[model samples]
Target: MKAVLFGIFLLAAGNASASCDLVSAPCSTDSSGNTYIREQNLGGGYNTYRNGDLYSQTHQQLNGTYRETYSSGGYRTYYSDPNRGATYQGDPKGMAGR
Candidate 1:
């Protein structure tokens, strides 16, 4: 009886830990043959998603700008200017005049 209880506890704990891990895959299938997915960080950060042919993502930065590129085609970019406490967004461009 004690061994069974211990096994059950371990299984529950494992499940809880697994929930905090990052997941990357199709979450569901719709009637029109569309799929949805969510990508997240296990720790503490941003989450992103890709649905059908469209892709979108976001990130949490500690000090500077955060940038990411998608496999579909285009890219998403963001930045926080520490001196002015402002944020900027646009396509992936070179930082020369800033």
Candidate 2:
């Protein structure tokens, strides 16, 4: 029983470390004067929330594509390995944070 409790505690701690919840994650302002909030996704991506809403979600793909899906249902696909630029689709709004 003690080991089970310890395992549960460890799992919760790991989740807390990667959460994108504004109350838990660190926040910062960009040079453009926008405030961004960060969150971690359980899947293959991380999120940036702005003004209490999901501004963008950046995810990794098996084919080495890094895609950022924005609030407007738009996206930008980039290569993760070489760290190249992104190809935009849909209406491109900047990734603002919550």
Full-model lDDT, candidate 1: 0.43
lDDT of 2: 0.58
- On residues 17-90, what C-alpha lDDT tens digit does candidate 1 reach at each position? 33323334424333454343444567533333434343444455665566444455555455643112222122
Candidate 2 residue 43 Cα shift, in angstroms, is 1.0
Off by over 4 Å in 2: 1-26, 81-98
Best candidate per TM-score, number?
2
lDDT of 1 at 29: 38
lDDT of 2 by residue, 1-98 (tens): 99999999998876543333335564545455445565677984678776557788887887878777778777776655112223121212343231
Clashing pairs in 2: 20-39, 36-97, 49-97, 49-98, 50-97, 50-98, 51-98
Backbone clash count, each prediction separately: 0, 7
